[model samples]
Target: MEELGISLSFSRPRVSNDNAFAESIFSSIFSVREWVDQFIAWYNTEHRHSGIKYVTPNQRHFGLADDICEIRRSTYEEAKRKHPKRWSRHIKSWQQPEIVKINHPRPIKSVEA
Candidate 1:
């Protein structure tokens, strides 16, 4: 590690991009670790992930995501109602699934009789 100048950092689960970005910023291993820590904190608490209906991971973890999504859904519905011409189609869904998986399984096509 010392000869090659390689630094090891533990980043957030399922987030590969953070490790490389932090590593490229500084040469010091401690710097990488520190930055990764800060990034993880901010990512979980402040970042609104679209995967989770634009709610922070902390909000989803604490069971506040449902209410937040409900508010968004209501607001969007109201806006569409007032301005029908603005949107040509349906509004985006704020509904969060029971399991937030990166790869959802393809629905099996049944053979119709």
Candidate 2:
């Protein structure tokens, strides 16, 4: 790898979780809905990764990461408005249903011999 000027890093074999992010990328590559190679092609060209401000890695590679925040934030706010009521800081106790009074009288029970 060094001969080709490629730098590589390794994590401990037992600590797979340490490399989970990279492993997850590979796992998703195989598990994505579309074909792996095709998805990877599209992912590289089209999919915007959230980690790098929702710009595709290729965009970042080609120096297009600037001013993407406004676009991302605007989309985020638009999504927030569309979402259903999720929660509130102040909560009220559940109100019970209104009780209705019954006007009928109770029947007397008969004694058996």
Q: Which window of 10 residues has the lowest lDDT sum in candidate 2?
A: 92-101
Q: Residues 1-113, candidate 1: write the lDDT tens digits.
A: 53576544455544557667656666577887999999999999999998899999999999999999999999999999999999999998989878877688889999999
| Cα TM-score per model | 0.63, 0.30
Give me the runs in candidate 2 sitting further than 4 Å from their true place: 1-34, 70-113
lDDT of 2: 0.59
Instruction: Measure candidate 2: CA RMSD.
Output: 23.0
Q: What is each predicted model's overall lDDT from 0 to 1?
A: 0.86, 0.59
What's the residue-level lDDT of 48 in candidate 2? Answer: 73
Candidate topping TM-score: 1
Q: Model 2, 1-113: lDDT tens per residue?
A: 55777545466533437777998998887777457778778887899765565567676666556546556556555655676364333232222212322364668899999
